[model samples]
Target: MAYPIVITPEKNNEHYQYLVFLPDFGAYCQANSIIEALRVAVKFIRDYALINELPPMKLKLPHSTGEQLVTFVNVNLAAKKGK
Candidate 1:
């Protein structure tokens, strides 16, 4: 199953970080880039799915706040240690 992940850039932090929110899991993952964040988010959801049922996601993506991004997390990916 695929999950919707919203990427929002962190501005208040000293170093730039991307915040990944998985709406279906009601979870978060942080990384330096969107791809990396989504990758992490995918792993998160997979782990969560193994434990509990996932929530139904919205058919439409979230509206961008001009500084944020909307993306889907594909759960099929195998994790690489350094990715």
Candidate 2:
């Protein structure tokens, strides 16, 4: 399933470069780059699904500023179940 993620540039934060938000799960993660952010977001969603009932997918995305980007990250929970 593909879930919408909002990526925002973190200002003056030395530890990470971007903040990735998963609206459906009300969870967020940080990474040093956009690619890494997406990777982390996938892991987060997978782990969340493993422990809890999956949240309903949202058709509408959260509002983002001009500097922020909104995109979808695909995760295959069925494939993860075998691990």
In terms of lDDT, the best-performing candidate is 2
Q: What are the RMSD figures for all models against the true structure? A: 4.3, 1.4
CA shift at 21, candidate 1, in angstroms?
1.1
TM-score of the candidate numbered 1?
A: 0.77
Question: Model 1: per-residue lDDT, tens digit, 1-70?
Answer: 6677789999876664888887766677888877788778877877776668777766567667878888
Winning model by TM-score: 2
**Candidate 2, residues 1-83: lDDT per residue as tens digits?**
88899999999999999999998988889999999999999999898887888878876777888899999999998888775
Off by over 4 Å in 1: 77-83
CA lDDT of each prediction against the hidden true structure: 0.74, 0.90
Instruction: Give the least accurate 10-residue stretch of model 1, judged by summed lDDT.
Output: 74-83
* Model 2: pairs clashing at backbone N, Cα or C within 3 Å: none
Each model's number of backbone clashes?
0, 0
Taking all chains together, the TM-score of candidate 2 against the true structure is 0.90
